[model samples]
Target: MKLGELLAIIRRDELDDESQPYLWSNAALIEYAEDAENEACRRASLLRDATTPAICRITLVAGTSEYDLDPRVIRLRRVRLTGNSTPLVPVTTAQLDEEHPGWEDETGEPSCYLTDWETGEIRVVPTPTAVGTLELQVVRLPLVALNDMEDTPEIHARFHRDLRHWIVKRAFSVLDSERQDKDRAKDAESRFALAFGDPLSARTEEWNARNLPSTHRDGSE
Candidate 1:
C-alpha cells in the first residue's frame, strides 16, 4: 500500500477529527507509520537480502588478516572463498587463535572466517595468498522511507493489514489511551502472526496450518 494512504487511514480512524491538528499531525502519523513498518520489517524478515554485494574483496595485506565488509550489511548468512562453491568454514576469534596460532605466518585461500559483527569486519585466517573475492549472502536494512504524500512503503502489500493494525496500536499508545492501546496491540499481533506464520510450530503439518497466506482485498495479492 502507498504510505500516504496508510497514514491517511490512521489519521481518520485512529486520530479522528478532534485530535487532527493537535494531538497528531499528518507528518507525525507518517513518522509513526514508518517506525511501525521498520519494526514489522525486522519482525517478519521482510527486508530482502538483495542489497548484499555479490562479492566482497579480501585485501591481501602482507601482515593483516582483517578486511572491512559493507557497512549496510546487517549480518552474514554465508561466505565463500575464491573459486569454492561451498561456503567457507566459519570460526570464532577464540577458535581461530587457538587452532591457528601463527595465522599470519600462513598464506593461502581462506579456509575459515571470523567476523566482528560490531565493526563490520571479517578476519580470514592465513591472510589470502592472493587477493580474492569473498562471495557472500547477507541481510540488509530497507532503504525506503516516507517524506511526502507520494511516498510509498517497501513492505509487500500482503502485509498491509498488519501494518495498519500496528499503526493503530502505536496511535493509541501515543495518545495515552491505555485500554484501547492494549486492545489494538493485540489485534496487531494477530495480524502479524497471520502474515508471518506461527513461530512455535514443530510439525510440518501444524506449521503449514498456521502459515496460511493472507490475501489483499484490493486483489493485488
Candidate 2:
C-alpha cells in the first residue's frame, strides 16, 4: 500500500483526527511509518530470509582473486562456478591461507570462495586463468526511503500486514507515552507481538519440526 493510504489507516485505527485532543499529524505518522518500515525490513530479512532476487553472475578475470560486490547485497548466500552447478566451498581467509599458501600466485579455476561481508568483497582461491563465470546469490538490501506519499515499500507485500501493525505499535508507543496512557501503549505492544512475533516463532518451530527429527530428535523410543 501507498504511504498515504497507510497513514490514513493508522489515523482511522487510532481515532486520530483534528477533533481529538491528541493531534497525531500526518507528518508524525509518516515518520513513524518510515521507522516501522525500516525495522520491519531488517527483521524480515534476518528472520525470514525475505530477499529472493535472481542470482548474479560475474565473469572471472585472469589473475584476479578479489571482486567488488554490489552494495545492495545484504547477505551472500552462495557462490558457485557457473555451469558446473557445484557450490564453492566457503572458507575463512585464515583457512584459505593455511590450505593454499600460494593461492594468490596460483592460477587455475577457483574451487573456493571467501565472502567478506564487512568489506562487501568476495575473494576466490587459485584465481582464474581461463575466462569463467562466478555466480553469487545474496539477500538484497531493502529500500527504506519513502519520500513520495504515493511511493510503496520495497518490502514484500506478503509481510505488509506485519509492517502495518509494527507502524501502529511505534505510533501508539509515542502517542501513548506522550499522553501518559500506559494502557494504550501496552495494547499496541500486545497487538504487534501477536501479529509479528507469533509468525517468527512459527517459522522457527516449522524449521525445527522439519529438521530436528533427523538431526537432534531422541530416537530411543
Candidate 3:
C-alpha cells in the first residue's frame, strides 16, 4: 500500500482524528510508519538480499582484514570471495584470539570472518594479500524511510497492513493530551507482538542465516 493510503487509514479509521488540525501530524506518523517497517523487517526477517550492490557486495582492499559492513545489515548470511567457490566460514573473534594467536599479523587466503557488532565491522582471518571482493548474503533492515506519499514498503504486502498495528500503538502512546491513550496503546502493542513475534537476537539471527552443512554426511550433495 502507498504511504498516503496507509496514512489515510490510520487517520480516518484507526485514530478517528480525520478532523481539521489532526491529533497526529504526518511527520510523526511517518516516523512511526518507518519504525513499524523496520520492526517488521527485523522481527520477521522479511528481506534477504544477495544482489543489492550496497547491501550484498563488499569490495576488498589488499592487506586489509577488517572492513565496515553496511549499517543496514542485521545478520551476515554467507560471505565468499569473488574468485572462490566455497563460502567463507563465520567465526567469533574470541575464538581466533585463543586458537590462532597473532592471526591478524598473517597474510593469506582468509578462510574465516568475524562480525563485530559493536564496531559494525567484519574482520577476515589471516588478512588478505590480494585485492578481491566479498559477496555477502544478508538479512537487512529497510534502507529507505516512508517519508513521502509515493514511497512503497519493501516488505511483502501481507505484512504491510499489519504494520498499522504498530503505528496505532505509537499513535496512542504520544505524550500530547489529545492523543495519549495508554490503555489502547498497550493493547495495540500486544496485538502487534502477537501478530509479529519478537525479533531475533544477534546469535539467533546468525544461526538462522547459515545454510551450508559442515560435512558430506549432512547431505550437501
Candidate 4:
C-alpha cells in the first residue's frame, strides 16, 4: 500500500478519540520532536560508550501495521567515523602468487597476499599502497514508528509522502558518500568517472555522454 495510507492507518489506530481535535497538542508535538532528537543522540552516545571507538552503526525501522508487532522485515547496516584508521599489515607478493596461482594478472600492480591461518583460505589482497589504513562504514535504518499516523487520512497521506522522501534522501546520501569514497581510494581524479566508468574512454562513450552532464550537475565534477 501507499505510504500515506499506511501512516493514516497508524494514526487512526493510535488516536481514535475524535473528541480531542488536537490529538497531539503543540507541546506534545514539540516534545515528540525533542524526544526523537534526544533519542537519536542518546542512542548514538550509548553506542559511542559501548564501542571502543566513537563509531557505531545506526539502524532505523518504521513499523507499517503495528508498532508493537515485529517488523515485517528488518534491515540492518553499520556506520563508522570518516577518519578512523584501521590496521593493514604487509604481505609478500610472491606468497600471494603461490596461493592464488590461477588469478590472472588483471592490474599489473604487485599482488598482496593474505592467509586465513585458521581456515587455510589463501587469497590475493588488493594493496592500497598509497592509501594506508582504510575503514568501511555502514549506514542502516534501525527503527521507525507509524503509530496513529494512519488514523487520519490527511495526516496519513502526508506522513507517507514525507517518510518516503526522507528515506530516499537518506539512502541516496549514503550511496553518494560510498561512491565518492571508492573513487578516492582508486585515486581517480573524478568521482563521476570512477562511479560511471571513464567518460573519455571510447568504449563507454554512450554511458559517458548520457550521464556525464548529470553527474557534473550532481557535483561530481
Candidate 5:
C-alpha cells in the first residue's frame, strides 16, 4: 500500500482506542497525529521520487503528569516500504540517546535536555512533580535508503532506529498541540470573563462554540 494508505490504517488501528481521553475528547491530538503522519508520508514520497533514503524527525511536548501516568508509553511507530512489504518499527529511548548523545539518563531512558535541530532549539525539563511535559522531534535522512534495503541485521537495526525517531516525533506533536489548545481555551476563557464579568457564562459560551453545529440555532423556516 502507498504511504498515505498505510498511515490511514495506522491511525485507525493505533489511535482507535475510545477509552483514551487524549484520543476521544481531544480533537487537536487526533488532528495533530493525522498531520504528522501525512507529513511523514509526504516526505517518504519525496524520498521515493528522489530514489534516496529519507529521514523524518518528530518531537512531542508532553506534560509531566501525562508522562508520569505512563512512562513507557510507545508514542510513535512507523512503516516503511521494503522489497515486498511494509515493516513497522517502534521508537525507543536508546535510539534517541544514540542520535543525540547525553540526552538520556545513565539507565538508557530519556531525560530532559536542550535539543537543537536545524530549525530551532528548546530547553526541555520535567514539569512539576505531578505535572510535566515532553518534547519530541522527528528527523528524516535521505542518504540511508539504499543501505536500509540490504538483507542484514545491521540494515534492519538502523532502519528500526530511524523509524523510532520519526514515530516519537509525530507522537510528540500530538501532545504539544493538545497543550496549546488547552492554553488557548484558558486564555479565551480569561478574556471572556474579563469582558463580561461572568465566568460561568463565558465558559458556557466557550463550550457552545466548540460543540455547537454551524447551522442557525433556530433551524429557520
Candidate 6:
C-alpha cells in the first residue's frame, strides 16, 4: 500500500479528523510509518538485497582485513570474491585463534569472513595482497524516510498491510491528552508482533548471542 492510502486508514480508525485539527499530524504519522517498516526489516528480515552496489559491493584494500558495512545493514548473508566461485565461509575470531594462531597477521586471499554486528564491521581472514571487489548479500533497513507526498514503502506489497499495525501501535500510545489510549495501543502492538513476528529487542539479544563469533567457536558446522 502507498503511504497515502495507509495514512487514510490510520486517520479513520483513530478518528483522526483530517478536516479538523489532528493530534496525529501527517509528519508524526509518517515517522511512525517509517518506524514500523524499519522494525519489520529488523525482526522479520523483509528486505533481502543482493544487487545494490552501494551496500552489496566492497573494495578490499591490500593488507586491510576489516571493513565497515553500511549503517542500514541489519545482517550480512554472503560474501564472494568478484570472480571466484568459492564463497567465503563465516568464521569467528575465537575459532580462528583456536585453529590458525595469529591469523590476523597473515596475508593472502580471504577464505573466511567474521562479523561483529555490534561494531558494524566485517573482517576478511588473511588480509588480501591484491585489491579486489567482494560481492555481498545482506538484509538492510530502508534507505530513506517514507515520502508521505507520493512514494510507497520499499517493503513488499504483501507485507504493506501489516505495516499499518505498527503505525497504529505507535499512534495510539502517543502521550497526548486526546490521543493516548493504552488499551488499544497495547492491542495494536500485540497484533503487530503477531504479523511481523518476535519482540525485536528480545529477538535481537538472541540473534546477537547466536551470531557473536566468540560464541560460535566450533566453526566446522
| Candidate 4, superposed: residue stretches over 4 Å from native | 1-3, 18-20, 25-128, 131-139, 142-221
User: Per-model C-alpha lDDT, please?
Assistant: 0.60, 0.61, 0.80, 0.28, 0.30, 0.80
Q: Tell me the tens digit of each residue's lDDT in model 2 across 64-147.
A: 888877655545556677676567766666775787786678878887776665566778887888788777655554544666
The better-scoring model by lDDT among 2 and 3 is 3
Q: At residue 203, what lDDT does model 6 achieve?
A: 61
Candidate 4 lDDT, 99-169, residue by residue in tens: 65644433322223233322322232442223222121212112334234222212222222322222222
> Which numbered prediction scores highest in TM-score against the true structure?
6
Worst 10 residues of 5 by lDDT: 65-74
> In angstroms, what RMSD does candidate 4 have relative to the true structure?
19.5
Q: Give each model a TM-score.
A: 0.67, 0.65, 0.89, 0.19, 0.18, 0.90
Error of 5 at 99 (Å): 34
CA displacement after TM-score superposition, residue 61 of candidate 5 (Å): 49
Candidate 3 residue lDDT tens string, 1-221: 99888989888878998887877888888899999998888777788788999888878788898899898987776778887777777776677889889887989988888777767888887788888889987789987778887888988887878888899999999888988999999888888887788756877755554332121222132
Answer with 1 or 5, whichever has the higher TM-score: 1
- lDDT by residue (13-104, candidate 5, tens digit) is 44443444544333433343334333333333212221212222222333321122111111112222222122222223455467756533
Which residue pairs overlap in candidate 2's backbone?
A: none
Task: Give per-residue lDDT, candidate 1, residue 100.
Answer: 72
**Model 2: how far residue 42 lies from native, Å:** 2.9
Q: Which portions of model 1 show Cα errors greater than 4 Å?
A: 17-22, 50-64, 175-221
lDDT, candidate 6, equals 0.80
Residue-level lDDT of model 6, residues 1-221, one tens digit each, is 78888788778865455675776788888898899999988778888788998999999999898899898887766678898877787777889999999898999999888887678788898899999998887778997879574768998899887888888889878878788888888888889999888776756743753363131223222
Q: Tell how far residue 213 is off in model 3, in angstroms.
A: 12
Error of 6 at 80 (Å): 0.7
**What's the distance in Å from true for residue 64, model 3?**
0.8
